[model samples]
Target: MERQMEPWWKKSVVYQIYPRSFMDSNGDGIGDIQGIISKLDYLEKLGIDVIWLSPVYDSPNDDNGYDIRNYRTIMDEFGTMEDMEQLIEEAKNRGIRIVMDLVVNHSSDEHEWFVESRSSKNSKYRDYYIWRDGKDGQPPNNWGSVFSGSAWEKDELTNSYYLHLFSKKQPDLNWEHEPLRGDVYQLMTYWLEKGIGGFRMDVINFISKALDLPDGTIHPNNLYGDGSPYFINGPKIHQYLREMNEKVLSKYDVVTVGEMPGATTDDAQIYTNPYNKEVNMVFTFEHMDLDSGPGGKWNVQPLKLVDLKRNFEKWQLALHKVGWNSLYWNNHDQPRVVSRFGNDGEYRELSAKMLAICLHMLQGTPYIYQGEELGMTNVVFPLLEDYRDIETLNMYKEKMEQGISHEDIMSGIYAKGRDNARTPMQWTSEGGFTTGTPWIRMNPNTDEINVEQSINDSTSIFYTYQKLIQLRKQHDIITHGSFQLLFADHPSLFVYKRQSADEEWLVVTNFSDQREQLEWKDCDVTSKSREIIISNYDTLNTNENTVEIRPYEAFVVAFKKGIEN
Candidate 1:
């Protein structure tokens, strides 16, 4: 029998680059395609197989690149179309593939299609977007925008309101229309034909909405209502995605990951099941939202290690053979992982490595966001004007209007604002990103934490990430082994085991700042010969039953299944 081959993406590691903050080669203060092309060597050195580039499409900068104006053209600030093509070619030259951001749920109101659709009620493109008549001098529904306020925007020319789940400038597309879906398919085909690797879809689950556009339940403390129930993973989401796969995705040999905000484990199984052919995997927000209070993302709260372990165990076992999972710690819209989940002040390097080992050792593909390998921390801008994220600014303004104190609002922003991940990449101490002033302020601690410094130090977080990536490629157990969570209820320790037919790997991580002990009776290794694969600490000691774990320390021990002591 012929040997079977698995998908290349299953064994690959991805690195996400927020183009606007990655690098700037033209001294224009904004990262561009040419800038990314210049750093191909750096990414190659990191051993990442795919570069998940955030949106670089034409936009008005209202919500950064997320609100795209043109799907085919590159943003002027990020360079021309030629530069983008060069980036694709250059990245490929270094054995790296580029994954573009697919933002089909909505487009900039300034887009030609939206402009034409809103030009007149009788226009041919009017059905390209979601529009409905107002109700009693108000919006069509009491839906709230993800960026706050109402989700409806009135248009005087058509005498109607258009739905925008995010920014008013981003009018949601009418996926119910056949022609609109065809157009999106064609655009996707264009990129895939251009030698791009895959796509990281933006809010893909929100593309389908309830046809009635019903009003959501109103929260007592809020102005508008929660509209996610009507839009997220709607009635026809599967039909639309299956159609999309058949029309565009199935023909290509590329990977696809959808960013689903409200997706549950069951929903994810349906979306990512190989037989369904919807997507290769989905980015679930369950783990990310664990640190939030009932008030939502801005309501900052401490993360419980037990809660995190249980959540991971549930997903790992639920999707083991049924589907796949996409693991990540930080992204463009999230706060820095080190500052949020690890100790960024005293044991930043050790904590960062621990977090990496905990996630990478799981049974899924891992993503490393820009500057995450350097152990970047959250930036606490002193003033509201210093913050640039629309969500942050809107929350501050709305809270102040409700008689909230400046100190309280600022504290939340410092702890959970999206701008925490938008700081420029720290390549060096002296304005490494650009010659001109950065669009957003650089983190003040960039002097001590940067790629240059990290790469030189053997004990830096960058090397730890590099070693983890290398391990995934070298060991089949890391990719195909079954996962089992040990010490599930431990308050400060995360312990897991991955076992294959003839190999077993033990991954232990200390989530707290204090030393802990791992004494799992079921995970005894007295007779098996053990090898320390990778560790954050310089020295380690382990006995047959229990191991003494230092503060924020992590290590992986490998054993040959049939070998004796």
Candidate 2:
């Protein structure tokens, strides 16, 4: 097939709505499909074309809706099928396309397929999931679940084990089963036919597993092994995606973004290359993973600006010519970015806007999580009992077992817990989200930080995001520019340049709270030809010699037409 023309997804900005936290129309304390439908006008004014709703599928809420029991039905807590249909119609009326989360990496163990597969060894659905004989008297291998403990759980009746990379309630599907692939493809087509614009594939790359089930190498202090090698970007992942593209994706005007935790730019290029027809882009956690300590996500450390700069530059440069990227900092699985990467105290708004600039300046599609645009900081729950995330709870239990202090584990949770980003959307001084009570406690600072306040204040972080999205829509430099990292080793300064054939844009952000001087003379960008385009602070000065930027001050300078002359 010939290359398809540049599509709407490339030009549009996407807003991700974690359905459970966005709003509650029924006063049921949980955000639902109708809640989302009620907020389309708000999203339209924010200028996002695509709305990515996280899974509202039927589930046991074991992993907060990521575990799917029925692929086609809506969760009872969320709403009914008619509510989802109205959501689609209303969003379409407002020029917004809806994209559902595709969670096929695993399904809820309650799903009929898993139920049948687990019933008897000779069942027709037994091969639909990965099953293996126990090794000696233990789990099949040393593989550990991503949530915690062992990846394999033995069925008492069958005396065999089934694999679950996540919670025990979610079983990994067997991609080697051609019939299973057809079923998934058929479900995808069903959604596409219903006017669902596209999909944000959940752990899409993990569908393929290694042919040989081998024990992973063990870490020194670990009880089990790192089982990522057994599933992450395994041998058949690309082939499976290509087949998926040919069968479902390429047939419609749609966009597909795969969530790949351990993939590199080279791997991403193949997954997103237009000619290859696999996906439109891939979300690589290389930049987001910067704050994780060597032990991984639970062990949080200070984020090194140099490391963050390096990773973003590498992916931007690597995918500049070959493919596409989906840029993000806040997501359901991550802590609030402003809390993790920015100063949340006196300079909250300044630092939040600075972080936004630092990422949005890159050449890629940007995703704004539900409350990210309002400069939402992490929730501070003094007691561990206040937290609700399964990952956070599991980590706490494991750390307590390891004899770590309550303060130490809570410190890590404060810095990197997924619950930090899962709080309900602050929509009013009182009642826009819920009437009686919210599912999660509302951040007490909502009076000053909610959507009503942000929308009223012209200088709020919310409006800054609006301007950023508008700029993206109007500028081709954003869509087709090549990236160049300005100062790779700057300790407190993060600077980069985006260049097209005739124009160049320089984005400078001070990641720290200290004032810094830009040695523009160090780079070839002549100061005389540049014009200030965007900045968080009102005043920034560029004299003949040095450009002075204030604490957490951020701005973009664009080289005008014929500046080189």
RMSD of model 2, in Å? Answer: 1.7
Query: CA lDDT, every prediction?
Result: 0.91, 0.88
Backbone clashes in model 2: 0
How many steric overlaps are in each model, in order?
0, 0
Model 2: CA > 4 A from native = 1-4, 561-565
Cα lDDT tens digits, model 1, 407-484, are 988999998999999999999976499999999999999899998998898888998899989989988888788999
Q: What is the Cα-based lDDT of residue 271 in candidate 2?
A: 83
Model 2 residue 202 CA deviation (Å) reads 0.7
lDDT of 1: 0.91
> Model 2, 1-565: lDDT tens per residue?
2213677787788999999989888888999988888889989989899999999999999999999999999999999999999999999999999999999989999999999999999999998999999977988889988898899989987889999999999999999999999999999999999999999999999999996888998996678988788789998998999999889988999889999989998898788788888899998988887888887887787889999988988888889868998999999988888888888888899999998888877788999999899998898886887788888899889879999899988888888888888889988876377875777777777877889998999999998899899988888888889998988999999998888888889999998889888777776677788788799988677777679888889999888657653
TM-scores across all candidates?
A: 0.98, 0.97
